[model samples]
Target: MLILTCPYCGVDAEETELAPGGEAHLKRFGPGASDEEFRDYLFARENPKGVHFERWRHAHGCGKWFHAARCTMTLEVFGTYPAQTTKPPKAIREAITAKRPGWTWREFE
Candidate 1:
């Protein structure tokens, strides 16, 4: 089991306390965007063997959606930030500082 810190709740929570949402920072289609463009946006995922950015909802905490950089293979959580926060995190930075592949760093940007 992994522990994730809810940026809002400010406490480390079990992975059970959260629900995996989807790819993070998915771009929305603008007016007149083509079907192919929309389809790519909707269905594509990196599914990288290493670190990946994902969305998670604090289902048992603040009920807020947030960003988490996770390792696909190890299910390690690197860091967490509120989705509505002003600044996005530097993905590489979080991944590197994560003590283990499964520990989450709770820091606000």
Candidate 2:
């Protein structure tokens, strides 16, 4: 069972109690943006086999959204942080680095 600790309520909820919100740290495009940019924003996503960042909502708990870093293959969670953050927390990055050296995801390394 996959368990994620909600940063808002500090509750370690199971995946069944939460809702997956797709990829995190996406570059959103709004009005006046090119059609290609909009398409990429909506459809383009990274499905790496290694460490990945995702958005999760604590539906059955605090109802707040947060980000989680974990291995897609192993399901080994590095850490979780508030979704309001523009980037992963330093501690989370460090934890990922400790487990997977030379890891680089998007702009995070």
Candidate 3:
């Protein structure tokens, strides 16, 4: 089972203690956006086979949401970061690089 540490509550929670919040860093397409753009924002989500960034909530703990870098294929969590940013932090990126060299996710290197 995956273990996620909630930075706010300081709880090392199991997967059951958290809730998946889908892909993070999504650009909201609202009222003024074109129909196609709105539709794509709502439905066109990337489901890649490898590394991906997602949002997770510490539902059973602090109830705060955070970002996580994970591998879809292996279910391995690279690291977690604050949800306030649109891109993964440098430390998390370095950790992923150390574990899996040549890894690239979106605008992160």
| Top TM-score prediction, candidate number | 2
Task: For residues 1-109, write the lDDT of model 3, one tens digit per residue.
Answer: 8877776777778999999999988988768999999998899887889888888999988889998888888888877877887788888888888988897667743
lDDT of 2 by residue, 40-94 (tens): 9999999999999999999999899999998989889999999999999999898
List RMSD in Å for every model shown: 5.6, 1.1, 1.6
Per-candidate clashes, comma-separated: 2, 0, 0
Tell me the TM-score of each prediction against the true structure.
Answer: 0.75, 0.96, 0.88
Residue-level lDDT of model 1, residues 1-109, one tens digit each, is 8777888888788889889888776777997999999899888766777666678888988898888776778877767888864445676454555554564333435
Task: Indicate the residue-level lDDT of 37 in model 1.
Answer: 92
lDDT of each: 0.73, 0.92, 0.84
Candidate 2: worst-modelled 10 consecutive residues by lDDT: 100-109
On TM-score, the stronger of 2 and 3 is: 2
Clashing pairs in 1: 76-101, 76-102
Alpha-carbon lDDT of model 3? 0.84
* Segments in model 1 whose C-alpha atoms lie over 4 Å from true places: 85-88, 91-109
